[model samples]
Target chain A: MDLATAGLKTTDHDGIIRIDFIERNILDEANIQLIGEGLNHVVDAMDEPKLVICFENVEHLSSAALGVLITASNRVGSKGGQLRLSDINEQILEVFRITRLDQMFQIYDTSAEAMSAFS
Target chain B: MAESPGHHDERRDSDSSRSGVVVLHDVRTELDSLQRAVVDGIRHAGYDEASTFAVRLALEEAVANAFRHGNGEDPEKVVTVEFKISDEKVWIAVEDEGCGFDPDAVPDPTEEANLEIPSGRGIMLMRAYMTDVSIVAPGNRVEMVFRPAG
Candidate 1:
């Protein structure tokens, strides 16, 4: 099923939410703020949110976008949930590695792997 | 010449370097076009994919920092972006209208104790991706240079 919640295009995969960002470049500050708000709303609705965000469509993202993801990850952890990032291109993944966010977030090679890893 | 008020963009191509000066008062409408132009310049100058990504990411972080932190999101304030794209390297500068702050005071986001902090990573990202990054005194302006990987 497709979900229009927040700025995300998500699908339900056996209760695991597979998320894809609507924008190719997730850079704009205002847009990042909106995505963060949307994520908070989704996380609040779930008792233990298990989400897999695929970056197949994302070409460019700024540090602000990473901040939003970190905030959401903290919220999910507080609620005993899990979040996974997958399908990140090499260059974008380098951004994660540079900031050491790779250690904080679980990343997978594909969305399917990310979804399967969710418990 | 520096241009401000509404939006002004001046582009020039020469044997030395291709220069672009943009003064953006409305970030929402103007920022993306500027990025596109920069990417196009990099492509035209035959920069590799990695260099393109590095310059583009650093540019985004710098510009966003100027708009959000430096300009304080004031619509009346303008952010200025200046760039010189060359065959071997790319140089960019982003300036805001607000008074600058101390960059050293920005804690390292990668520190073990501060891993979960949601912000304060822009400067770090710029420094990581760019070959050289410097903030002009007063801290309102940042200049970065990225040389194609050899």
Candidate 2:
């Protein structure tokens, strides 16, 4: 499943998965659908729930997109796995802070940090 | 260019002319269809992706405001939108038929009192995304502008 049409790529490393939103755009419905669907696929393919989603190139995000992120986080959490965010741009991070979702999910400044934190 | 009241041209190519008037309509559900149409028009006019998204979101907030507050959810009324692009600037105006609102009266979203509230952020978001924003219809019309992305 395509999580975003904006050229996002997924990678698996040490049971930690990283999703990079390759192109820069707000994480709106179109891309969210892709992200959500793709995340589900990746999780299903994994034997464990340990995964970290890294929004590498994303610059802005809307509330709708955040909803999708929360949904993915919950899915990972329910399976006794972890969901993490890393490399989030400041503008998009402000939206997360404003919506108070920053408190719900663990955020890191880099992918390695997120993967290291995930257990 | 002004045409006489008696003159009518059905195929004036106004959408492409860039010289036509853009009307601003109030925010209302009845105008939801129209708002989508305007966004379609903007897309058809070849605006970039970011601009299109910004305008669409801003238009939704504006129309929702008109519906929930301005016209008091009156379905019979109408909200109008008019816009034209020229000299690398796109001007958009939205007008509602509802009682006017005070821009100053709106709570600042950044203020502590308004931070948790969802109602006050729409206009501020519009202002942040658009190059210019103004209330022209007193109680009804909102106008915004964006410079065409190079």
How much lDDT does each candidate structure score? 0.84, 0.63
Candidate 2 stretches greater than 4 Å from native: A1-119, B1-36
lDDT of 2 by residue, B96-116 (tens): 678899888887656655433
| B47-137: candidate 1 lDDT, tens digit per residue | 8888888888888888888988999999878888999998988999999999998999999899988889988998998898899999999
Best by TM-score: 1
The total number of steric clashes, by the backbone 3 Å criterion, in model 1 comes to 0
Model 1 spans > 4 angstroms off: A1-6, B1-6, B14-16
**Worst 10 contiguous positions by lDDT, candidate 2 chain A:** A24-33
CAPRI-style grade of the A/B interface in model 2: incorrect
- In model 1, the Cα lDDT at residue B49 comes to 81
lDDT of 1 by residue, A35-99 (tens): 88878877888888998888998888888889889999999999999999999998889889999
Error of 1 at B32 (Å): 0.6
Q: What DockQ, between 0 and 1, does each candidate earn?
A: 0.71, 0.07
